[model samples]
Target: MTSRHLLWSALGAAAILILIGGGWLWSLPPAPSVTPPLPIAQAERDATIAALKPPKRQRPLIAIIGINDATETTDYLMPYGILKRADVADVVTLATKPGPVTLFPVLKVEPQATTAEFDAQHPDGADYVIVPAMSRDDDPAALQWIRNQAARGAIVVGVCAGAKVVGDAGLLHGKRATTHWYSVKEIRGKHPTLRYVEDRRFVVDDRVATTTGISASMPISLTLIEAIAGRDKARAVGRDIGLPDWDARHESDEFTFTRPFALTAIGNTAAFWARERLGIELKDGVDEVSLALAADAWSRTYRSRAVTFAATADARQSRGGLRIHPEQVASDWPAERLLPSVADRRPADVLDETLHAITARYGARTTDFVAMQMEYPRNRAAQ
Candidate 1:
């Protein structure tokens, strides 16, 4: 054969192979999770709780830290709201700097204090420091502050992909940890010395703790409440939040990057012209946990992004006292653009309700895609 013809033949052969490989991958289901069913026994859970107990103060000072520009909504807010509701610890929200924190996929919140301000106020450091996922994993200021808190005997907790920040801070070395399902491989590779445990919503090894994903924040906060106050207090808070029991139990295997999920995300993204800017109303006494979850979930649909609207441009204080800045005036936002009201639902169940609403509007695959993004287990049968 001529050289050109041979080259053409090789190119055709390569194209055919590429198509076959692509088809195979596209047809295949998500890889089965290798996580085991080894549930954390009560004794083990108690031990972890005890390990994180405050060393000195009767009411431990807890700080939930976020980045100024971009922090994950639920990851930063759920813990603050839940812990505040529990009232077991003196909870404060701190930003890495002095500005309103712009949450990913939704809302903006004013933090209670800046890291520098907190440090100045309490020279002894916080009893527990909660880290949420930020837009940039390698923000030098955040990393240094986390490292300093860990060094000062604060039990550091990393929620969701905040594990990356904690790992970057060099505290997860030689510790057993877990993070968002989507982040497991990347975070594990980043911190090879850390043993990555799965099938649990949260993992604690010594003073450093890590959780599976965004929704895991609720359980982890409950666990922290249990650690500081008692199981009874945690349960009381959990019941009030619509979850009667909260533990480390999680079916990590259930959440994965499946073909259907990928297709839904791709399809939604490709149809960007149809994207809508849905608004949720902000008001005094709104549940911050519910607001965060609802806004975060709706924004992840790819079909829509949630924006907050209030009567005025003024900030609204949540039921738990987090200050939320509305994106627009309520009158300015069209009534049609408002998302299905989650205002009537209990704070904890709003996410599930929003998921159902998504399923109705988009489809089950899109709903699952949103759930997977949040690392929320939608299969109640398995639970």
Candidate 2:
């Protein structure tokens, strides 16, 4: 063949090869981006089964103490949920008296057993006693009960201001401890002997473990679970609960003790009043408006919750015809007093006016209102 003919023949062969290779590649299935689940190790499977199996003798019993209008909701519920979910302990909510225990942030919970009942059932006392922060500091009876539990060698875990209760009970007389940043000074003042450590999410001194704030309950609970079970078991439980990388050593100083405004917005537009009437109107932008008001009210670090004056605990409609649910109601406002109000959406002047009005109402000082928005049920309340 001539030189041009030979070159054309070679190009044709190369083209055919490229087409054949491309066709073969296109016929193959796409590669997976994610890794497939690995089979549980035999030892891990056995350990899990053992951990989950109902104890023939007695499972590690955890008593979560609740007091009337005292217990912080998240502090109590988070540990209870985590321990129970981990299957490391038989967690029970205990109270000074039998009945509904009112938790902060307008939550009402009934304890599974009273102190007397629990004492009667387990004469040796609880393996672990979890205490949440209370509204009042001077509960002689509760303090005494806590002392008794500690004396009986129960691992006493205090969440947030529960450290005060622990201190008041003489548990932290000389032991190192910590609490919510806002109360650190107060705690140190009251219990001068306590070694108040900061920046730690949870601190363990001897048998007692004190956590920083409401959210710290999670990591601390995982720590407890790890101690009761094993690291693998704890990791498995954490994975099951969507907290696969939880570590107790982690510290949360994000919502430090520095005073932050506790703003609660109240009221609902006609559209927010009747949810069934209008489905959900995004154009009205009620949620966005409320978020804007919240954002503008205080520093992003401040705590706030949306509330309405509607009679029932049902969803409300916003002025923009959006169905919205308020975190609280007027009759059952979490705080003793209400802050000033701000419009949902308006000009800068209006926003500034609203902010000014709120600050003036709240005395210009951004007080720490941690209790107002701390505790909430892990699961949804039954309608």
Best by TM-score: 1
Error of 1 at 333 (Å): 4.3
* C-alpha lDDT of residue 111 in model 2: 70
Error of 1 at 74 (Å): 0.4
lDDT of each: 0.82, 0.54
Clashing residue pairs for model 1: none
lDDT of 2 by residue, 1-383 (tens): 22222111233244345445565433432321223233335564444333333222247888888776546655665577567667767878877886766554333445778899999998888878888887665678788898998888787889977888788888898887888755788899998889987545567777787877665676677767776777788778666544566433322333432212111111111122321110111222233233223322332112232233334545544332323344444343335334333334332233234345435543343222222123111111110
Per residue, candidate 1 scores C-alpha lDDT tens digits across 163-278 of 99999999989999999887899888888898988688888888998999788898888888888888899888888787887667788887775666656665776677998998
The estimated TM-scores of all candidates read 0.90, 0.57
Q: What is the C-alpha RMSD of each candidate to the true structure, in Å?
A: 7.9, 24.1
Candidate 2 matches the true fold with a TM-score of 0.57
The true-structure Cα RMSD of candidate 1 reads 7.9
Off by over 4 Å in 1: 1-21, 24-38, 381-383
